[model samples]
Target: MADRVTVIGWDGSPLTAAACGALGAATLVAGAAHHLALPEVPASAERIRLGSVDLAARRIAGHRGTAVVLADGDPGFFGVVRTLRGPEFGLEVEVVPAVSPVAAAFARAGMPWDDAHVVVAHPRTLRRAVNVCRAHTKVAVLTSPGAGPAELGLLMEGVHRTFVICEELGTDHEQVTVLTSDKAADHTWRDPNVVIVVGGPVGATEGGGWIAGRDPAAGPRGWTRPAQVYGGELGEGERDVLRAAQLARLGPRLGDLVWDIGCGSGAFATEAAAAGAAVIAVDLDPRSCARTEAAARRFGVQLQIVLGTAPHVLENLPEPDVVRIGGGGAAVVSAVADRRPQRIVTHAGTRDAAERVGRDLSEHGYHVECALLQSVDLDTRAWTETERSVAFLLSGELTRS
Candidate 1:
């Protein structure tokens, strides 16, 4: 007498009596080959193997009688249930949830995951998943067959991160291996795995404690100050010039969201956020995120640092008013242009990268302006030596033509 179709979660375990009854009564049942081979599936039911998820959704949609869709782990968290039960099909699904792979992986690692950022790495969009691993301190990556531990480790080669790869969770072949980012890249791993990146320190497990909404203003602490004010081991005079030029090019205003791509020292983002704009700094290094956080605290500003590589990660963030691409190449410039920000600025160390930025912006309808500035350092001898560099500043405005 149940009116709604049921979507069941099977975690490689024997089906319960309640699940068996549902499966037996189902006129149509769809799941992966591994899931369909289970003994609990009724002999007479029409079985559709899940090759393409969209195709499986169609099979479930066409069924006239009681239909059942089986998925692995929690169907709600990055699973097929969301796709199957959407408005296009108008099929109401009763979900029987199971322990999510992310949860299981974290549990096996003996780590708390409530504060961890969760991402999925499928064949289609693994780069974004890599970016998530780069940007956040603690992350749980639900990996697909081709995008497992080795692949992830390879993509995150230079970044300093600790990888805890949990394979075949809840199954007999279950193995958990902890490795440094470099070590993980060197080894092959099993499919259906989860990759956990511990961001802060190796053993430190705690939330960043960042509250939602605007951060408290550093009272009497001016937001944008001269780079010399942030004197540190890394804050050299040459860096000061670079910081000043970057800030001048970015021109972040109050309430604007600035995307400081390839934020090296977090100087630009820190200065902008101090100037009253909300800043999200993107970098591939976890160490960079830590450094940026420290710099923000020192300068008394709210700057959110995302540990991920760009172009892919940028697609997932909110559109920004201003963008600064301090590194990466023409692809980075083109990606930011696609988002159609009010202004885009890029600093290039090489001539080839500079030309690409100029051409890419022009093609995207930007009133592109490119400039190459070389700053000369006057040392104790009072002899000036110019540094070699080039920058492209592209400004896009409303043009009727």
Candidate 2:
């Protein structure tokens, strides 16, 4: 009996005479339940249903006679072959690969997958898979029993991704459905499916050209942006004043995480996100939260928006290196002061709010600096006359005396 390992690929096809002969003489066979059900397994051979990759590897190592390990689709591409032949097992594996599910799914959809980011949405790793879909353009998610279309669809609710659910590939019951993330949530899909997330605008070309093992936008363009060009929904006149005052107070820098409280339209949050710092924008108004999300998408930066009241909402969040309170009351300012950010900036329309925030920072052992800016936009009359209205801008930065 040959004491060697043989890996085989199965695709619901009848086992060839040669394959039957090999399996009939084999001393041990290991595979999933579906693979073990194939008629090719020798009646006398010991069968091990692959429960875990580690257990399967152990069984293969202990086997003395000719052993065959069965795998689904292509074992080389995000499959079981890698785990079986790793250093711990050290067993030589002869790879017999079939058409991978990803390839089959893309083929069924009549789309090219060279640019797709392939990920496995197993129960244990679904969060990372969701994050990949959130951050990347194209993705092929290998879904497991419960991590199928509905779950993935829910995970991708807010992000812009079109789903192509390819179920039961290479089988008689094969089906493919294309839907937006919202519609996918309502539809139940079959198991052993591959979900393709089309990236970019639904009808636009995906990310243009691609590079090997590199993100589409991975190059000289590093993250982060200045406050002036943050590009919120503000009018030209309002934007000018807010941009000037925000830059003067917040003073964002590289690698720093900033919190934008009461982040209306997320202008400050977008600016900080563009600057390469992680940003979280919170607002009580649901519309504002939606607007913030839209602005972040337009700018191609990651800005998390939480729709809720501040102070209470900020309680559970991670500490920030810098905080800018665009709207909130004294309690919100005091709560932010307790976090002791390296810098704290607040825009105040009233003198009382400004004085309260300044005093709170001072009481927290910070040397508070305050500034007020008044700007007026001129309106031309029929005779080319000018009219003006002034708005107060108060900003404060806290530093240790």
Candidate 3:
């Protein structure tokens, strides 16, 4: 068999006798700068700092002697294990593990994590990580430099959550602090940190015995509907057709924010919530807002109901990934477009309104398209549902590199 590149996991504690034995025999060792400084590492052995892991792996692959990669927490976890052993490196390896930092963070807080969602907050993955934090009741973020605690806090603005930040776990400089997401944004955080985002106190939210992270059923629904359809801007059958078209274009999912301007019946708002995105339903009418809130409760979903007019109310709400214009005309559409939501879906009872919205959206740099949706057939037979409708839906999406 080929020689194995022994990967050792460290938890800032004294090295085990076996780890020490492996270190003593190793001819080449790789780790972060701090890990290379550990006294257990033999001075005679060549040290490789993982500033560039691929470089270190190349060196290890070329070395004609025993090689070991020292890593924090469990090497087999979201650490260096996969990189060193995968087809890119394809090196044989034996792992000597220690308590993972995530476990250490949860332990320091004295919270259980059997049902917690864990994510890595890196440059490419930070947005999704933040979205996970937003949607889940409990989440643990393995943070990176630019995507650290403060960034997470900022992204989490307008959403209520509790944050537990753990730094330098298992070391003398270790510290654990708990604060609200609002306050977390104001503070600077140390690197090599793990952040736990909790919706509320752990005890109140703990019920995950069989399933992991969030209960799949409770998280979000693949398809969403309101408890009961109230007659409003959209009629009974019309709502379903238009909603399907809007949802398909908007693609609201967990970790997205969908702003519904003049959220007439609250059906669209509830549906977006059911898809796991945070929803902010805005309208000037007190009755509309109340009905939306009621529908949210009945559907067992949540929505931030703002009882005010749009173009002005939207100023205070969090950024949205999608915007649905129900009643507001060109002004509302223009207001939502200014925020640069990835997609915008609006309706018009007339062709003039639709054409006007399409022109406004196009002027604002959106690739626009319009469709006239009408009921072409009606079931005249008694006991069969029938409908008559004609409406225009204009959809716009901003181009991004």
Best by lDDT: 3
Report the C-alpha lDDT of model 1 over 1-401, residue by residue, as the tens digit: 22457888877667777788888888878888777888878889889887787887776777778888888888888988778777777777888877888888888888877667687788665765765565446778888888877777877654567899988886789899998887886787887788898753321224334532223442335434544444543322125555666667667765367888887677777777655565779989887677777777765555667888888988778667788777677778878888887777766655676676677777887776656665555554756554433343334431222
RMSD of each: 10.4, 9.3, 3.7
List the candidate 1 regions with Cα displacement exceeding 4 Å.
1-3, 201-229, 232-265, 269-343, 346-401
Question: Which candidate, 1 or 3, has the higher TM-score?
Answer: 3
Cα lDDT for residue 39, candidate 2: 80
TM-score of each: 0.63, 0.61, 0.84
Residue pairs in collision within model 3 = 115-213
User: What is the descending TM-score order?
Assistant: 3, 1, 2
Cα misplacement distance, residue 40 of candidate 2 (Å): 3.8
lDDT accuracy of residue 3 in candidate 2: 80
User: In candidate 1, residue 262 scores what lDDT?
Assistant: 81
| Candidate 3 C-alpha lDDT tens digits along 101-178 | 999999999998998879899987787788777666688999998999999998887678889999988778899999
Q: How accurate is candidate 3 locally (lDDT)?
A: 0.80
lDDT (CA) for every model shown?
A: 0.71, 0.71, 0.80
Candidate 2, residue 270: Cα displacement in angstroms equals 6.4
